[model samples]
Target: MDRALGLACSLQFLGLAGAMIPLPCASHAHVWAGECCPVFWGDGSPCGAATGRGRCQGVAGPGAPAGSDFRARWPSYFFRRLCACRGNYGGADCGECRHGWQGGSCQLRHVVLRRELASMSPGQRLAFVRSLDLAKRTLSRRYAIYASVNATPGAPLAFRRATVYNVAAYLHYLGSKTVGTPRGPNYAHRGPSFLTWHRMLNVHLEQEIRNITGDPSFFVANWAWQGRAACDVCTQQLFGASRPDGRLYPGSVFSSWRSYCTNDGPFTGNMSVICPLGNEMPITRLNGWNWDIPRSVFRGFPSWQDYYACLNLSQYDTPPYDANSRFSFRCALEGFIDPLSPADWGIHMHNAVHVLCGGTLLFSHQAANDPLFTSLHANVDKIFEYWRRRNPRSRYPRGQVPIGHGANDYLAGFIPVYTNEELFQHSVHFGYDYEYT
Candidate 1:
């Protein structure tokens, strides 16, 4: 078992490194929407001529400052051509208006509200679940999944169709697997960028859901980890509950939901993958009754003091901004650098919630497969927002961050690719705020 686990870990590392390899095209190719005609490389043509919303331009590389932790690799030196959106025009091909703006000429401002899932009425919860299911079955109109990193442009089986929900889940999985250094683990997690990366991720999914459901009011629900402990919201009335026999109730919407991109095959295998078609599989518990591993006195929920301690931290993030550090906002919020000891037998805030949910949520690669992943992270973002409000002067690190987490570095696979610095103010830029009700 140990040997097999070791091999899987090794392959996952290799796959992660390969995925971060820059494609032959420029940085603009990283944007989604419309096909790129390579022949018109630097002519500065509009991405979508019909829209006339943006023109192609040279992509700028973030010249890492001296003494920076980021090396000149992948995103740091990923200089390429890209579309420069005009005014409020956005999207990879400059074919659509930016998030808050919507008009013939992209002149409007809108505010989106995100509420706690547990606070939602039964009707609202039902609608949210239905929207998620619809997203799972609906084919993505703008994007296609690449079969492999090595796939040639004209290869017959280079791309495959994917549902919007699957694409979101796959992006999360890929983000978790992306390695900054050839010899290290994923750069997306356990760093200053952890909250920022997830903030962008939730925004992306919320927009996708809005597009799919055609409801501009739709927002991802936040699950406040500090609010409860017993998985009270995991009921047939909300997200489904498991039967004594370890199966979802027949009447629950999630019972009919299927997971996508769940294959754990060797890294060398084809990347094009799909979810199995079937009824929702029951999320497994670690022990007979407890969903969390190493069950604690509070059943995986942190005490009020835990929340107080994290919220009271003064710095956004300290030096050596990785998980092992004892001084980072990222580590503090994640419960990694905490005051607790082994005698507590308890996990910290963000991780405790993942463990409490168990099954797919317990693993980084498969956590997003669970529909609840979005809401879970929403709450995490809320905590970050809370901390930010408390420490109004706290600023995101401008230098020495891991690759892809740098101030100007682009997040992989996002259209109109957002940099870490661009994502600093969630409500100001993304047009969304967390409502505590």
Candidate 2:
């Protein structure tokens, strides 16, 4: 029934806007594009690539107790007042709210709003990660309400437990400002591709895990490159294609070349394949951008799943943490607790935010500090949840998905690792919804 309605809507939309229009076509409000685009302005999306509209679902609230007023000010003051439109979907205020849509408050029920979770209080959010650490103790205990994830443990549920452990370690690392490689001054040096960020982050996680657990076995060993090798060596080796000079292969680790940084300014790497000029440019992935799941994965897939899962992995014992090693990786199979097949990447993204950032919404902060420091770690958790859920039944060739499940089942077997009750217990405080005028 929903499919039929969707089809009807698609047909109606097509009829109203010309059945077949070229990419980058400007419509009544938005500029349609086949290529990915990055969002500018002070919109609070992390790497705001053109994955979809900002979402409003997921956990909400303040990260700090008194910080609510400061946190609320952004949405209340700025978001409510929509920005003016700019060139080719570019705008000073990001596309304008259509007629009848109130701009004073960002709350346009029909439009997409920034859906974020808080992670202010590590002491509080850490419990969710701790549960996975102590999974053996809670295996039999039944809570009044279980996140759909608790139901399906998957065959050899220990693998799931292990996966959770891996996730926990990574989350703990992100939450703590522990020692790791720092983001450099040159944004291009960091290579702004989505996978680049993940790789850098994983490297940091691996180092932190080793520091804490004293086990190198917890790390996944992969080849490391320096200088020019950083750009295309992995892609050329993994896939038969070479990155055009100046076009950084953002998806080098991940099989797909679809980058969250694809649309965010000129990137340096191999660009002959994408650019006609073949200019050797430095890669750039700006703030406020994102990447959606690979399109091919969803074209021939299943139902809508509400639950989410988080994967955990441990590093293999080796030369401890390699300051020079460019790559270190591992894989984990994810199991969904629910049967719902995800229809859109947004669904997985929405739920993941809660798991990662939900608990830190309303913590007590000192002054005009940013909640994002807390919120960013939460976003990391949310992405991990999304990755685990998307792993079921589907095979993501490039990145890690545990051994047992098929690629398509990746999104299926995933269940929300954290529950509402657990979140409440771990939360420093809760966030109030933004009101629109």
Candidate 3:
């Protein structure tokens, strides 16, 4: 038996059995509407022109400081005209239905129930692998990435065609970039916006897959790592397996898969900018800590006990709402501090998983190169949703934060205006739900 799977057979996530089921919708009054599109290279229809779905409008967001990266408030710096979509309409051109509602008329309620990785059947697993490969091979139909003549910071912004999966990878890469700060602060991680920003990532990938595969029921799955004592899903049968040199096994389809945004640009910042397309490299990963190798923290895995403890944290975030805010669930779960061993700088939940899954995953900018990043975040999303249920009336923290992390700040690369707080609603509102605990 494979060591990863063999060690995982005894594992069971707390309160979650990896069952796939329909999510019950919350009684929330409204749902998300509209999509973000840059006028330069949108859906090519310019907000579904002559369709009455939307029209081009001027960009809206906080002002960008001079010489900063364009993705700070998303496409605000790149394009002046953005799509203002109508009810139940969304996407780059407003030609597609909103997240929860599908159909040509935007009248169907499509609730995606994301499954757990280990619970997927053999056939389902194969289909998922093939579908993900399809996403990797096909160019995005609804959106385009901002490419430039060179790796220059203010290089002339030209829209370029990128594989659908690269869009997913680039979102994370941009999210990790410092908006205007000279130091290392970023939009996604180590802040109150962490959970909300990541939530939209999963939603974006799933919706893009649905659009690409023409399968509205298509959903992503999570790796329930809380109960496992190692990185169990890194295998030929699951995400993929890699050899000593950091290349995937010959038998895996992902072995031939190349990733975008591999190298960083020379731009000034904590970590420089990432130039897409020309920087393509092979997808790679290695579970530095595992069953046989008990190398990393907690013998290479996190405990369900610590995970559940984070859920009980009352405030969404406290003062100085970055990674240091204690008693704040966002900070603890982000692995900036060990909630249990408060004094130690041990990686706790989400960050630990990323660290243990080393190589391409060691750096936040390149982590998404390995598809397991999505699975990890899927589980993270589940935990965040669980926290929401636990604290129903708790709202977003009211305090200044890093750029691109404000309650109403645009998720660094989201073309259609998505905000940090807008994602606080139940996943059901977005037409999706987690089947596991």
Q: What is the lDDT of candidate 3?
A: 0.67
Collision pairs in model 1? none
Q: By TM-score, rank the candidates, best first.
A: 3, 1, 2
Give the worst 10-residue stretch by lDDT in candidate 2.
1-10
Residue-level lDDT for 318 in candidate 1: 67
What's model 1's TM-score? 0.78
How should the candidates be ordered by lDDT, best one leading?
Answer: 3, 1, 2
Cα deviation of 436, candidate 3, in Å = 3.2
Write one digit per residue (lDDT tens) for candidate 3, span 1-437.
10011001211111111110001100011001112343323335557656677787876667765444545535444345567788898865676677899877798888878898788898888888888888889977666554333464434333455778878887777666553443345777768898998899888888889878988888888788886766887788777888987788888878888777755554413333344346677777767754353223343457877787777777788767776677788887877656565434446788777767776777776677678887888898998888898889989775877777788787777756677888988889898888753
lDDT comparing candidate 2 with the true structure: 0.21
What TM-score would every model get versus the actual structure? Answer: 0.78, 0.17, 0.83
Estimate every model's Cα lDDT from 0 to 1. 0.60, 0.21, 0.67
Off by over 4 Å in 3: 1-52, 151-157, 179-183, 265-273, 289-299, 342-344
